[model samples]
Target: MQLASNKGLTARNDNPLFWSLRNAFVRGDTNGLDRELRYSFQSFLLRNKFSKSVTASHKKLADLRYPYDWFPATRAMQRTIHLHVGPTNSGKTYHALKALENAETGIYAGPLRLLAHEVFARFTAKGKPCALITGEEQRIPEGTDRYFASCTVEMAPLNKRVDVAVIDEIQMIADQERGWAWTQAVLGLQARELHLCGEERAVDIIKAMCARMGDKCIVHTYKRLNPLRTMQESLQGDFRKLEKGDCVVSFTRIGLHTLKAGIEKITGRRCAVVYGSLPPETRAQQAALFNDPNNDYDFIVASDAIGMGLNLEIKRVIFEAVTKYDGGGHRVLTVPEVRQIGGRAGRYRTAAQDIKDNHTDTTSRPTSKNAPAGMPASAGLVTTLDDEDLGVVQAAFTSEAEPIKAAGILPPTFIIEQFYSYFSEDTPLSFVLARMREMAKLSEEFQMCSIVPLMEVADLIQEFPMSIQDRLIFLTAPANFHGTGQKQVLKVLARCISENRTAHLLDIEGLDLDILDIERGAADVNNTQYLQRLEELHKSITLYLWLSYRYQGVLTSQHLAFHVKSLVEEKIKDFLDNLSFTVEGRKAKRQQTRLLVERHRKLEEKILGDEPSNEAELVQEGPGAWSEEGHEEALMEDEAEAEDPVGLPDAIREVVSDDRLPRPAGEDVRT
Candidate 1:
């Protein structure tokens, strides 16, 4: 029998723990054996204890109503919650935020990064020390005392005790995708005053949940400040009448691009586009362009992304299609979505610019007034191309919004694994989350959201033999999947993690650290695919910042990461803004963003000033080649696959896909 030299088995043999265990067996001394057993036992015991506590918690939950308050973070705290409820632009959040601003120590958690950033910028500019903590970036200034913190809801600090905690878009607690973050924030935040801000739909459910948790809840309802009314007449796809304050809505990326390009080409007016895929920097810039009355970017093309948080002065919102792909299938826009996006058409204008004229409400529906109830308005209109769905839009005002039940949840990665271990080997990842849900019912700490993403990448991690820590890093990495080459970027990160180190730009082979190295992505951005690469690099910089925040001591290169982030942001902005500019001109003016043109030129001259006349200052180039680390390893494995292919141990192979291993000549690759 020919014995195969298995790669996985070889790795297993070389592991330090494996050697320790082997030594215990070989040595006749009982102490050595006992030492190794204790290490293993301790690890298992820690995990097992967590499992038991969660299981017991679930059993007891059946007898109690307050499943959320059991968490140690919230145990001593009898939360005093103030519910600021109203429609969009009703000043609910604005007033709630005023309360947050007055508090000595506070946390403002918003559903979107843009919203958190707005709060961060507003607070910081007001000279009130503020720290911005999103998933990928941390902007905490030095020498600031008791700084206010603004963060994405998922990044909300559970342990921190604040004078006030503000949760924006509280209606999202009913959202199947992100509800858990709102839920966790509401349940875990130990604030003296917890402020929930959103529409009236979430009011009852929030009150009920707070009541059950034994917290005091109060409701503060407000009327919209501006008059927002749907148009009496629909556009019906008439491109001839496209005007300056018109925002055309599309559902998908292709739709946004096509509509934008076509509208700009026909109307000869620059169109500012806003979609979910655009980086937050680009989105803000585009919005600024559209908002400026003096600018030629009069027309706005956007997705549902423009519906929330963006206070735009859009005179009309034209829906291209009422139906959109909601992951599974194409479906009509929900009543909430229709109303929300339509409301943006007639935005609350500034105090100086008054619209004291008659309301612009067009439809004959009793509620069809451009002005909201009890609020005076000017001209604001919402229309659609397809008249068949006009009735749906018309009926949106009276549609009863759904009540939020339990919040969605995603337990920490290790907890996910522990719960996963209990299920049979043949069980799918779907069941892992299903099991998590059943388990969370028993404990506050274990509350898990549907966690579809956890399932999506589970197989990808399983493909490689990785440590639990490595698996967790990959799973939690906030890398964008499409267009961006984040998958390749992730591979680089995985290799560094496997080697037990953090990656820096210096270690990335081709990356240059010189401040004036704008040529790094200068050439590539010309190609269509370069945008994706640039996006990936941008995301990679964020990944570094994220890791630095997590393990600050081990990954002490956050400063370098921030510098790179600025460079990449400049490159991306230049590429998007100056599509018509010559490559050389674009490169020369790339650093002109952020109002630093003269300063950038002076810095460039200074760096080159000390160098020889013939030499450029920061032109240290890579060998001008791109290489992926795993390619060589895969090639070597391919050679082995033809002869003595290695396979994983049955223990792991039973649960994980054996697809990573080479298949036999007659065997199906997938199976």
Candidate 2:
């Protein structure tokens, strides 16, 4: 992309360094000095493109500041960006998708995995070969040439050439945690025609970004395709008055479950629950139940998980409370979230007539053509419980969206990792990411890719005795701090790296095989206690999937691991479908389940055999071993053992569950 001068010879102003070098050579300067000068010239050519630290005191990062300069594709393409700005129920995304559909080659980057999968399905169904790429899953049809791809924004391929690229939810760039992806996409995505879809509030920010990036920006302001009106009155915390097409929004899992159970108990109607932890498949199934007119799922109760690109025909949105417990304390929902979730009610479009009846179309054309058969089409309503924030909800009714101030940014994995290698002697494992950011800010190629994975993976691997590579692998895996399977996963990864082989579950020795029991494999059968373990296992599987993507051919066992994941998922799915637990007095429930937990404990000891147990073992039995509350309480009893594993090497950091505690060699563990 460097512009060349019309004349063959370099201009005198630009050739000052060239002349200086020539004069030195003419003056009979030492060959060693000439060699050093030539190396400097090589460094100038590479600039930020590379870094070389042959020894100490030789590294300078002056030429590596701009992220856009790294990508030839980004530099060469003049973006034709169309901003589809509007409120919910508007055809903003519809117009954007139409352009993508008509393009010879394109990509659609969505916020949610469900939305990305849906778009991928839609394109592939229309006889266009498409790829679906998400962080957890990737699918490219067998023996097909992909011309388009639908993926989460983080997975958007920057190097590929395409006619069009659709970046959805452009306003999320202001999000404190995930907004960096949208910013990176806006600044770095190399596409001929870029469609940015989101609320009107982001219009100005996007225009400024486009101008800075040297891309032509076209603003398309739109009104709601279907009107959405705020309800004058609130629900006053009443669940009995709820009917079909009502969406009750709660912020916590406990509250959502309690509300859903109460609603079902009173109205004798099935309810669909959508929460973040629920899998994409489960969420889709729940939405399908609510969308189908004939289904028993008359009402929907969900968390803020429904606040994004999910489309549903909710007649009314009832916020259970105005304030949410945001980790630290209760806080009011932001104006943008209020609008995004509220807009789900009364979507404009409807299903094609005679889809299930006169037309009898069974071709799976897409949800757009299948769902929303009957709708009011005119207006929607957004309300809250107890009138706590009626004014707040109403403010979003007319006000523009809140402007985004900053985007999230993660540094390049390889570059920052290399930087850290030079400082491993003094650097603590806990601050690896923090240090990477500081160094990345100093780099020349630091423009867009600063969006780091916001969540911490595992309680930083405790065993520091292992190599940096092993520790880093564990750090990067999306592992739960208290997960039982993480220790084994680390062992397996170490073995794999050592042996230069992929590992399956059976391949790892000394693993607590008792976890294979998805149903707890015990007598009294308190499935609730087993569920905690299952959730941990699910997270472990997710870590494997993520690692497999990073290592590709190195983790060939991921496909087999998925088979085990399916078994665990089936148990989870069935349990959630018939969600229940013994709801009796704590004394009564424990009395009935005590003998059961004891039997399970003895069986687990037999499984562990003679292996010396670590203090880190998480005991499943003891007081509070039935409900999720009790399970957590039981875990808390071993709180002293759950030290933050920041200093230990990943190899020795054991995630021992107290399925059993120590007893005399011959005596049964006290129940």
Candidate 3:
């Protein structure tokens, strides 16, 4: 019977333990059965233990599970926290707003007036009391606990009270022209929670800053919602095969228009264009037309200005040229610029499916006979634009004139030092101190002066042989500082100045110069007879010095030996009305001076007030807070009358004030 039971167990595909237990039971041995059952259970336990260990090892290799040591701390911190950090089109703005919708009070600080207006409209649509504040506009809702301010850093003080403050495009904090405002906002904004959004490179810097401030900082990276597909071949061939909904990106305005015209000719559809020089309304209209799926415009020709934040429904992107003429010289495209523009190729909603089918070839060969080797090839994605030579120009205006030395590139240290030499030795170190005095002097003397003198100086400096000219070139060389067409225009201007000819600035409004060959273009310029006249003028020391000061290598080059002569043949009129100290009698002269000063003050006010055209004058308000009594009353009433649904306890309320909120308890969120 035991043998039969064991045989039955074996036939059922049971384990050896099952057969052992079955034989014990069949023998009617209680103690044996107990022993066999315990042994069988012990074997099952050992198998489970081995299986668990293997599963755990796999999880560790895959990083599928948090470590036992780290999970508890991470999980606790993850509960009340939110993060906003990513490249453009990564839904940073969307996620931040979602968090704001749940918060009791929220504030959004945007970079531009127009952006602030857009955000104001969005919040207003949600039935929230929102405010829009820019240098040109301000619409603050009275007494509302929640507010939205789309203001630069200068306006940060106005948004003193808020639960959460979101700083969009935190990368602007490093901007040369307006970085101070962003930096001030980050350091000075008084909010319980700060949410920053920008490029990934800015993450570590922001985290470090937050950590120094003793705030807990957390970083979150969001993958690109839409990634561009690779080009099968380079984009150097015939572009007729370009599908519908393609964007042809160009650097120069002329190039943009030329491509738009060419695309329209080929596709039989009107092409839209968005460039920096275009009016805001025109750019917005073009953006809308290009984004519209059913619109007659099937293509867009744009500059890098369209590379950020502008949403487009595009299937392909064509880079007509990879290089752009930065004001100082030609520069190659950086990875961020390429990624920003190329990232627009596929639509965010259908990236995976659409990107595969939309893959086009991008080739890099010598351009065709008519095309110039416009600029250097792009340095691939992830390459930083923070070259040391470039950093010198960025930090030039500061007191610390860090000498920029780069291999293969000319050092701009001597050039910058020469330019700064214009200031007196006693000059203050602060830009603000210098600016205040300059503004006061300008207001007293040249308040109504025409811009022609400044323009002339800029022109002469372009031809100037002094090293300072090189400094100016380096200063304006960056892609963002100057337009892509600036290099060609500057070269033409320099050639004209060298020949001593009156060079008429080309009006680019409707010109199609991009199609012209560079060699042919140079030949045409030489044929104008202006070159001969300019060369003759260059022999004079005055003209030579003017050119030297404006151009960099001219004065330093050993091949060029030119003496400095006064260039001003015509008497240069001083813009300022100089005050004279002498008079026939001392008392009479003093009285005359006092009367003149008062008269000048009134004239200044009237001139400044009337200077704007009718359209611009429409929104002018007398300088003051300029708010009506009724507005203030309404604000007070709105704040005093509102009900507090949260019934926030005294413990929290004590820390909250009219101008600032209580600081948040959780780890600080860094972009």
Best by TM-score: 2
Which segments of model 2 are wrong by more than 4 Å?
Answer: 1-65, 251-258, 274-286, 294-296, 323-330, 350-377, 389-392, 395-401, 421-433, 436-477, 482-495, 498-501, 507-529, 580-671
lDDT of 3 at 136: 25
What ordering of candidates by TM-score runs from best to worst? 2, 1, 3
lDDT of 3 at 610: 33
The root-mean-square deviation over C-alpha atoms between each candidate and the true structure, in angstroms, is: 18.9, 17.6, 35.1
TM-score of each: 0.64, 0.67, 0.41
- Candidate 3 global lDDT: 0.40
**Which consecutive 10 residues in model 2 have the weakest lDDT in total?**
615-624
Q: Against the true structure, candidate 1 has what lDDT?
A: 0.57
Error of 3 at 138 (Å): 4.6
Stretches off by above 4 angstroms in model 3 are: 1-83, 101-106, 111-114, 124-129, 136-146, 152-159, 252-254, 275-284, 325-329, 349-671
Q: Give the TM-score of candidate 1.
A: 0.64
Residue 357 in candidate 1 has what lDDT?
Answer: 27
lDDT of 2 by residue, 1-671 (tens): 02112432222233434433432332222332353365445435534433355222123222234544545668678879999988776777877987898899898997766578667756765678888887667887778565799987778988787889999888766553345567678777778999999888677767766766788999988786655778888866566777677898865444455567667876889988876556556766887788777778889987665665566667788876554433212235667778888887775332222222322222222233212335343457788765645877988777864454334445444454565565545444444443333233322112222122221332234333556565566554544444456556655665575556766655655343355663533565454455556656665666667777777666777777778778776765555444322222211222222333334345444643444422111111111111121011122112111211123232212211234444445432221
What is the C-alpha local distance difference test score of each model? 0.57, 0.57, 0.40
